[model samples]
Target: MNGRFVRLGETGRARVAIVIDGQAVDALEGDTLITAMLCSVRHVRQSEFGEEKRAGYCLMGACQDCWVWTDEGERLRACTTVVEPGMRILTTQPEAQWATLAL
Candidate 1:
């Protein structure tokens, strides 16, 4: 066995690819958009103040870094959302509606 390498288990595996910014991005099969996205590069999570690139932590649903949009014109949390074949996702501003937060 190579001392510099170790095999990955099923749990270590990730998604293959996803569409973002009008492009198909590579990722693990099970990775969230946040994980799958920034894996290739930073900036998946845009800084609140500027355009500096950022990445996500706690791949779980704790952090809100995985927010995105679906081809259906619906907003969703990337960490909580699973990949569906040909399903479009948008990782930008969520549709703001007054009725949703009036309570």
Candidate 2:
């Protein structure tokens, strides 16, 4: 588990489980997707253009840097999305279709 942000004497906050890259991670009920990842995930996504890594920037969802994907090929901004129970998320870009690949 990654480091937590809990304050001393804090208690009774509900937890919601979200699957990131096939791994289950716990997030507080009121947490935004970025906040959920910040509580446990070390990195959010890999840059598609290069090998650089990404976490999050502009917590208000203006930068568009913290996007994650779902199994159904839908993408959502992590910074503004809220955590929901049994939600499946993928930090990496989904596999490209064979027809989309160059010969």
Candidate 3:
């Protein structure tokens, strides 16, 4: 499930390190946050309700299914935000730390 979406004969884009939960993942330039995440991970976040893993439902920003947090705790919609180099991201809200710890 972790792979790049390369068009036939297309050259690779510049790689950037996008950190998720303190781990680094390679992402291509011009990739949205969700696209970059999808290249390395399966889910965008865990649901607060039941700790269910959630991926993006809407590629656009209208749906709230693809929200991710900055390391500083600010939330952003992953499908609309472009990935940047050295971005420290957290895949779930800080409140969801308990679910992660339980894993």
Candidate 4:
């Protein structure tokens, strides 16, 4: 185990399970689903057009690249959100709609 895992605090990380591309995964404690998704592959971000080099921009929930599909059918930004138990995350494709439009 990495030193970090051994020293997790009250804010300690816990292993949360999430589904990636239909496969179940146990992420690091306190680790976001996006981190878990990234472990499977270098770039977790995806576009409907299936671009391979997509990446998250403002991990603070300001950018659109980290968007992912949750099991509940809602799309959300990944970086600012933490992973929960039983979360099914599909880190693929672009959203059908953008809440805000920029010209």
Candidate 5:
């Protein structure tokens, strides 16, 4: 799939394999999560408020727009977090198994 961000330079770095929302993506070594994500996908994550998708507000860690989660429900700041090999990242929050159960 085509990504939002186009990699112009620095294409010779080592590649790191990561899974995003069940799809395999290749990220460069020493790249931040946001850089890795935006390079492989259109939007970083869907907005919690609505259907709108968010890329990132601030490239730095000062904003909360780049928040992402792991498959295990751990929250991570994409702007500051580095991409790791074999990492499984989820763009959407995993629903609780009991969420649909009646009280």
Candidate 6:
């Protein structure tokens, strides 16, 4: 799928591998998680309150709009967290995994 954000410049950075949901995505070496996510996906994450998707309100770490989780249930501030090679990100809350299992 096409992403919401397009890269107009800085195309020379090394690519890093990361998994979003279950799909493999390429991110820049020094990019923040939010930047990496928006580069390959339409939205940053699904809203916990409803079905609406979110793409982050604040680019900095001051807001809670960019919260995402790891496979291990660790919360991350996508806008402030740097993307790392082999990073596995879940746009949905990790607790949802348990909810699914319980169903």
Off by over 4 Å in 5: 96-103
lDDT of 2 by residue, 1-103 (tens): 5733443433368988889878898888878888888777777787777777788778898998998888676898999999899988887777643235654
Worst 10 residues of 5 by lDDT: 94-103
Model 3 lDDT per residue over 1-103, tens place = 3634433432378888889878778887888998888778778888867869888897898889988999777898999999989999887787677566889
Q: Model 3 segments beyond 4 Å from truth?
A: 1-11, 98-103
Model 5, CA-based lDDT: 0.89
lDDT of each: 0.55, 0.78, 0.81, 0.62, 0.89, 0.91
Quality of model 6 by C-alpha lDDT: 0.91
lDDT of 4 by residue, 23-91 (tens): 776677777655556655455556766456555665566666787777566787777678778887666
lDDT of 5 by residue, 8-97 (tens): 999999999999989999999999999999999998988877778899999899979998899888999999999999999988755532
Span of 10 residues, lowest total lDDT, candidate 6:
91-100
lDDT of 1 by residue, 17-96 (tens): 56765567655566556655555444454544555544555668897765666656676776677665455555444343
lDDT of 6 by residue, 7-71 (tens): 99999999999999989999998999999999899998899888899999988988789999998
Winner by TM-score between candidate 5 and candidate 4: 5
Steric clash pairs (candidate 6):
none
Lowest lDDT block of 10, candidate 1: 1-10
Clash number for each model: 11, 0, 0, 6, 0, 0
Scanning candidate 2 in windows of ten residues, the lowest lDDT window is 3-12
Query: How close is every model to the real structure, measured as TM-score?
Result: 0.56, 0.82, 0.82, 0.63, 0.90, 0.95
Candidate 4's error at 22, in angstroms? 0.9
Quote the positional error of residue 10 for candidate 3 in Å.
4.7
Top of the candidates by TM-score = 6
RMSD of 4: 7.9
Candidate 3 lDDT score at position 77:
91
Candidate 4, pairs of clashing residues: 9-12, 13-29, 13-30, 14-29, 14-30, 48-94
Higher-lDDT candidate among 2 and 5? Answer: 5
